[model samples]
Target: MEVLVKDFPIDFVVTWVDGQDEAWLKKYNQYSQQDVLDVRNARFRDYGIFKYWFRAVEKYAPWVNHIYLVTDDQVPKWLNCNNPKITVIDHKQIVPHEYLPIFNSNAIELNIYKIDGLAEHFVYFNDDMFLNRKVKPIDFFSKRGLPRDTAGLNAIQPRYDFDYIHVNNMKIINTKFNKKDVMKKQFFKFLNIKNLELNIYTILLFFWPKFTRFFDLHYPYSIRKSTMKRVISENQNEYIQTMKDRFRSRHDITIWLVRYYALVTGNFSVRSPRVGKIYDLLTTFGEAKRDLTNGKHKMIVLNDDANISETEFDSIVKDLKNLFEKKLPIKTEFEKED
Candidate 1:
């Protein structure tokens, strides 16, 4: 008989913002400039799919010990925040008072470890990421309570349309670790057969003497609270400067720092990157709807691409909402009764 590591309690921390809220909108408009990449309206506006995120969790990954819905003093009108399984945490709970009124997602995430009673093992999620299948705790954590992750490496793409944040992340990683030493120690994890398929770039740059940028899949991250705390503590000053930004900037390090920290330090287990995917609504709306309707992946990120016009984005949102309603029509404990 085998003793299973089934009892390890893991928490779920999801960060969300309601762009349409009048108070939040007022502050946002007052502080944000049109040029900042992160200020794009698509990042904040919520489609009707949020409630279904809750429904999917309740239906699929029911074993989650606790759920922290981190927000900006905002809760969905349909959400029952009082439910024992879910807690709505404001930015003030984790971010410092001086950083109050923070609009930067990176700044908000820099303080996530401060959440009261967060578990040692936790999964961090963007509001857009959702489970599409019945998943076990094993999918996130190994038997020893390590985060299961894809440790593939890639070169930094200077032409990446978004930001230079990954370059910043790699500079820190290379300084802290030698590629050879870490690879020697974590050989199986990096070269893991499951972790190999999507990592051709990883193998191509495998011997580059330094750690290159990692293949960042847009999905939930399985993280260790202690590892997150240690990384922030080690890089306190840089992070402090990053926290001062009211909106995102190219110089700021995103949550990928935490993921990279776990990867280099052997705090994670090998898992395939294909566990989920990111679907940009502008280009992939048709495929996204089909995947959602068919439950084609374990998780899928329905990205609100800023490149598309608002009218087109809204049309896609309406279709997505209808499709989600058809898939997960019933309300669960996370929602208030109709």
Candidate 2:
């Protein structure tokens, strides 16, 4: 279903980091304590996958107006700064001075909408996220200008845990709304709370069988810049808390809050997700290879969990390069000349 969204002019934003940069490393190690080094902070690994990501976008999402590469004053040597459609944004351009030398993606995401001259409609992509198939504008947004959301019941029962950031998200939601009212509204169905009646339910079915999971998918997020701004303006306290935590603290809220806020405010439309196969490099290389050969998914995530060894990691990178060479062999205009 093609929506006449040419006038909307959707843009793309990607956050990338090079962990090996000496200056970046100095600042990271300076502020990072031993306990927060590995998991809590952004784990930088060079997969050399950005080229393929550009190729994928050029091949599949040609309608994208501009590609904003958000980085901490780092740029790929092979990128073409002359490209009219690509903009490399340094952290200082959008992030405040005090938050300078930031390493956390969660913190960076909060300020993405603040980028000057950003399009009202934009897609946020992690460096690892890619568009594997041709998708129309309606796939992300409706003709009415509402973001299409794909969500699932939480895989695990929802509970509060100081170590888990997602649990912290749930805590904020529960605390903001009355327990019985949240349960009665059917937590999953509380997208719009304008006329929610105060009621009590002995069993909170939404949280019991499974809570609504908003952050599970690793896909390009369809975001509205104005909606994000409004959410931050309305929820100053929560937004401040989210921005204060430089790393992935348990008390910090993830970008999922923006999506949730949009939903609850009737600014988005929920759509059944057309999710493709997911392959974790730490465990499922064989299956990933088979699926890649078969072209089984419209999107694929090559996640680099810190559990793998140096040799295994190198092997995965080799396999990924081979796959991309065979699949997306064309060099994009965004690449520098040889």
Candidate 3:
């Protein structure tokens, strides 16, 4: 008898920009001619964002190999790992969109949209999400092997736009818009190609102050390279045709339309959050930190509770080390390619 091994591989990509920098904030205020500025608040947000980003990496690091940091700023020394497999891309080198505002996260997606050809399996994560602990991938999706996550069945948040572009009158891909040769080369042919439909991608069109927290069917956590290239090629000009407009609502609509494509094709999935689960998990870590020992895995702290003693935390961490070592056998060290 022969043994079969199925390797479910994934890459990691993160969105990062230098909007929180003091120098950039100063220049921004001067250009807008504003005396007092709330840009300082953006800086604090970045710190919170990056702290949890580190947590996500630690949790998912076991299954992921290549990590790409999409940014316009100078890569931080800490992010510059000695490991050769980890790659960082500067936005200027990847996709050169100058007119897009630096603060807008949607514009940065174009930079990622350009790199869709690089990785086959990848996860796209927001900097704002807090990932405090490691989780098994199997637990995130449904066991039924269905195309979509249960997160979609829940009532759509009021802040989310359910009908952004109105996918009613989409047309066929005509000769003027279709290029078979380039599409073939970019691996766009793999997807279920269809005529123009309403843009229904992820949470793109849902603007804040009116819409947010869209129960997107598109894999908010992951995307295959083929999907990214296909949508961008099909809707590039339709969404981002204008370089003059800074408003993100239109561009977001275009992106959300792509998410709809994934939903229909069964290429996307979502992990629904459980009630009280967040609080329970956070409390577990707090108690475990005080009860564990040292010589354990490196735990990156994200919370700002000053009263928590580091010495007690180290003890609890030791217990977690033992728990993982005894229960989880898979080693997380990166393997080199021959």
Q: Against the hidden reference, what TM-scores do the models get?
A: 0.96, 0.85, 0.54
* C-alpha lDDT of all candidate models, in order: 0.84, 0.71, 0.41
Which residue ranges in model 3 land beyond 4 Å of their true spot? 1-8, 30-44, 48-52, 98-101, 137-148, 151-214, 217-220, 241-244, 247-251, 269-338
Kindly list the per-residue Cα lDDT of model 2 for residues 1-338, writing each as its tens digit.
46765758888999988777787777777877733624532268778878889998898888888999999889998899899999999999998888666666777888899988899988898887766777777767778777876533343354544237676565655555444554354445442232122112212334453343443566777899988887667667766775666765656666777776664445666555454446788888787777666666666777777778878878888988998889889888999989
**TM-score, cand. 3 vs. native:** 0.54
lDDT of 1 by residue, 154-219 (tens): 777676535488777788888888889998898777887898575676778788888768888888
Judged by whole-model lDDT over C-alpha atoms, candidate 1 comes out at 0.84
Ranking according to TM-score, highest score first = 1, 2, 3
Q: Tens digits of per-residue lDDT for model 3 on 173-228?
A: 22222223322332222222221111222223312222222243332345556676
Which candidate ranks first by TM-score, i.e. highest? 1
